[model samples]
Target: MNSVRTIFQDGGIYIALYAYLALAMIVESIYDNEAFSRWTARAGMIVIVLLIGFRWNTGTDWMPYLRVFYTTDSSSDYDSVVFGIDQGYVLLNRIVFYFSDNYSVFLILDASIAVGAVYVFIEKSTRLPNMGVYLFYTSYAVTHFMGSNRRMLAIGFVCMGFLFLSKERRIWEGWPRWAVPFGIAATVHRTSLAGLAGLMVSRRAWPAWAVIIGLLACLGLGMAGLPFSGLEWLGGTLAQYTGISAIDKLVFYTSGEAELGTDVNVALQAALGVAKRSSVLVIFIAYMRFGNPSQYAQRLYNIYIIGCAVYFAMVGSPIFQIISTYYSIVEIVLIPIIFAEIPKLKVPYILYLLVVPLLLLLTALIPYLELYVPYRSIFSTF
Candidate 1:
């Protein structure tokens, strides 16, 4: 009892979220029935809601975006002007923000996205434990932070996009319809365009070597530090074609980072960012050793892993954390699917399920430890 108390006192909301998710995962693992699994899922949802509500009254990073949404005049000229680039997300936030100035709406949207993602996971990989899916949703860093809210929505859209790709077996469709949701998601956050690229890679009917080379090229760009000097030429070409400066602006946006100052913490984050990029190398090697995964899964995982590697190598920015965020989405679905394929490894299945989520929780906590520490006492106060 005292040990449990100590854990809570030390970790605060961090431990609370982890414990709730861990418990739910254990229960889902033990009970495979849909009804019971869903009950546990609802309980997890309630916990997320309660946590969001508690955090709402206190300030958090999401407050500013929520305020922008809630307080901004829909009829004002600035609404379209300020949000012209990422109109989809801005429009959604407007509707959500209309309800309240609190950031709870963001939490609600995140939870909804999580639930949708889990449903997609179950549909694609039915053998996965419900708790494991929920654990992945809760423990991932992207879901917890407000700064990446747009990316979170993009992840939700990615889930839907994956669902469409998975359904290709039934439909005689090529890529056009399938590409739309992902494109929309990309519009929500340009970072997600990588996911759409992944979808395209999955649908390719080419030989495996091509895929291998493509993955290598992505990694090489990171390691080689691909120059953007060509951006000026590319921007001019786009300007001639589109008659709009949007593409040029995007080029300039990414290019502008080169001149920005760096700090110790940012430098540390960059180093860790590189370490995280190495996970793509790990995933690629794992893919080669394990043999080709399912077409749809291959696309999602490869795209996600390559994006993480390439983005980190190029920018060395913490924004690359967005890859880790949604990659956990892929992990939840992929881990269980991979476990299902190896019946000979039955004895280790449960252990893998438990250990992987715990590892993800630890990785997610690295960035939050500083903020989480001062608030440890707050948990006891509750």
Candidate 2:
């Protein structure tokens, strides 16, 4: 309890940003006008993008990223294999560097790619765009916008491809829409190739029983501190064949360096990790099965089931958790669909609201207050 209170006290501005978004989501539920909702989503998206873009010397990895961006030039292609940076990301830095030497401009461009694409997915595909955006900030904003900038770009593009999958068009047509985007995402970060699982989920929701059983199995396996020797071998093999340095990171993260491996009270942390994911999957899947959510929401829930299964099973492995991150993003859009249908401030609605603070509380106990508190921007003293 003291730790959680300390997190809120230290991260007042950071938590307040979340509070602001939450308030907007609540207010948005009161409006029925499509035009107003559309414009409000746009306005919120723009604000989020700018907030991420304008950061100066903020975020956990900004300094490292800034160093790499400055050095990334046309001559940096061969460095990609050595530094574990992706070739496409190198090219992006080189292109942006040549056009403008300012790192702030590069930051803005990266923010546009990462944060902007998810916003696009929510606005076009979800029933409650504001709720989706707010949900995104709870965990994703700090992780993606503030760190893992390269993988975030890949996730963003993959999300764009999911947009095509969510459409009512022929299934074959969806393949064509994604090939280019998925390829581009792979070039940015190879781990995103795991996102292919999304293509396999049918538009129909999976059976409620199957999802429940699968998640329970995952929870048990994850809590056991499952090892990943085969995964380490696979990463080594991929790096050998592809000559990509970044793929080697997979091996490092899984070689007994996962949080569960290093931390004391591993069982407690492991339980919390799986519990947070299970809460959403169990609760959201219940609503998805019983409620009249749109076809798009069902599709998102289906992918989430797959993501959660992997996430829960790999709670002890950080590399595999990356795959789950790709899948779990569907919640930003899927949860909003359910939230929009429930009566305002009713039991169901309040249950949905409970989901938002779960991740925030989890983060508060770990890296959030330490890394992202006292937010700053290039344009201000903060």
Candidate 3:
């Protein structure tokens, strides 16, 4: 039993993860019954534990705070400001770090987020237990990026915010209440403020002319060859208001290497850039063909998808990558909804199931393989 625990703790355990993912995929593909799905969901929980166990060696990004909490007389001012001192996580770490202050906690957190996300996807998706869906959630895009602990918390909260907005009873009354959680997330990670924008877009009704004017203005600004200067000025303004010099450092200047990182190929990146424009195109068509969504929920989803598309196209910077990632959270909800609603060709459905995961995996691998040399041993570490 001790030897079994030791083996599982070692990097050799990732092979078990690979096997688990493969088996889970097969099981999901073969069974569609409620009882079977529930069983698979439980198996998914087990896989989550294994995956977390594999991450045991990978250090938590927030471990320094845990050390400060225990060892130092300092009053956790740093923790308060940075959200490194949240009650739930701090207490969780206190207990876990007592045993082993290694990477185990991070793994647990990552696994929890992945499991929660998968559970949500499964609940929402109309398609029966399919290998593609499981594979999609397990892929690097969701598992590595979206499931990264702190970011995942922000994402999970944002997803909850979306859920609140989507609920029929809560739609009218939820906005005021939703701000609190959104604000908490923004405090933890300012990037989460994007979710607030998402909330606003989701809730409000905009005039058709107003949306068109906004698009034209964005395009005009992009076309005027002044976006860089505009971004710099905006950064400076933000820095002055916030008194954080880092704001001016902005991702564009600091993340040039990351923007040009190897994770995204020139061709695929170009394609993504092109696809960004499709939001405007989608909105225009959706407007012309089906008309605007009648409910606040559908309207919000449409606006978010379109807004992200345009934003990605206009700014192909690393900062926007974070924004793009958050936007894709909405896509997780939207894609399955669309697949269920649209009477598309069967081949397109099959192709979408196959190609999307392949594309996401390639996107995730390129960056991990090319830009992040230090973390390359992530696989080996597991």
Candidate 4:
């Protein structure tokens, strides 16, 4: 009975999300009103932001974040209390703590930054902003937003960075513009440095054949159990830069207790998700091949390629699942942009409308590692 109730509660949240998506689509497609569409999108955004922001006693990181907030407030020792959180986040928490101990203040601000960033990106960057919002909830919610607050906030900046990077005339030349967002993202979450690196190296799309061959090579190496020294270096660098213990991280990863692992079953699921994400990549490439994509669209395509390369290369590492999930999310916004220019490709929109709901359903049913299960909140009890 408890399980059933939990399922229903989770179902309700999913329904709410899908309702927003459906309404946005209808307003855009049937009403043909961008103004009304934006209004509906804003309303929908509020519903979700409240649902997530005011959430209490739910999400994997909820209590942890609360503890950190309080610890940061009460503790005099900086290093001991700060833990592994970035200075930016810690400072934010301290500021919030200054006024009140209430966690909602922090929650509200965090959610606003995270969700607001994406909302701004969609409104500013995409013609079909509604689709980007739909894709965000369907593709990004479970793996990212449910529990992980700090990184989600960091990702908001990363999304903004993408917007900044997309508009650049010369990718390498516009440092000051792009650097602020990416730099903040990195300071908030060191993993975003990989995104910064991706931007630097992926100035143009690699040949499709090369991408394919590289992906296959990565899979082969992962399956063969060959070590990639680069990943080790990456782990070490991240650890050193972030002031976390590298040996402790390695032990935790190898302890068979990490959320991701080298287990065959985990690998298969990670690979399957990667395969699903590649479908979008393939579509983007196809459009690029057959259509006269704009310069900006082509640049996004190149970044997507780099995302794929990083994803595939991480397959053998314990962090593969995390990297895979991170890379999988870019397509939500990228695909809409790519197809926006090619109006004749009605199939992509059709597929998006049909496919996103399935992904949302999967997210609700699988429960996304069970972190999203038993969806309780401070405001309601199911």
In angstroms, the error of model 1 at 213 is 6.9
- The superposed Cα distance between candidate 3 and the true structure at residue 173, in angstroms, equals 1.5
Backbone Cα, N, C clashes tallied per candidate: 0, 1, 4, 0
Q: Which stretches of candidate 2 lie over 4 Å from their true place?
A: 1-10, 72-82, 233-247, 256-269, 344-347, 358-368, 380-382
Write the residue-wise lDDT of candidate 3 on 58-163 in tens digits. 3233344435334422455644333333444454445655776655455555456545654554454434433424453434333333234556556655555555
Candidate 4 Cα deviation (angstroms), residue 312: 2.1
Which segments of model 4 are wrong by more than 4 Å? 1-10, 73-81, 171-174, 201-204, 225-265, 316-320, 324-328, 364-370
Clashing pairs in 3: 11-382, 202-300, 263-366, 263-367
lDDT of 2 by residue, 118-200 (tens): 88888887657777777787767776666677888888888987887666766577576877778888988888888887877
> TM-score of predicted model 2?
0.86
What TM-score fits each model? 0.69, 0.86, 0.64, 0.84
lDDT winner between 2 and 4, please give it. 2
Reference-based lDDT, residue 314, model 1: 50
Best by lDDT: 2
As a whole number from 0 to 100, the lDDT of residue 314 in candidate 2 is: 75
Cα lDDT of model 1 overall?
Answer: 0.53
Relative to the true structure, candidate 3 reaches a TM of 0.64
Candidate 2, residue 58: lDDT: 70
Q: Highest TM-score, which number?
A: 2
- The superposed Cα distance between candidate 3 and the true structure at residue 145, in angstroms, equals 3.1
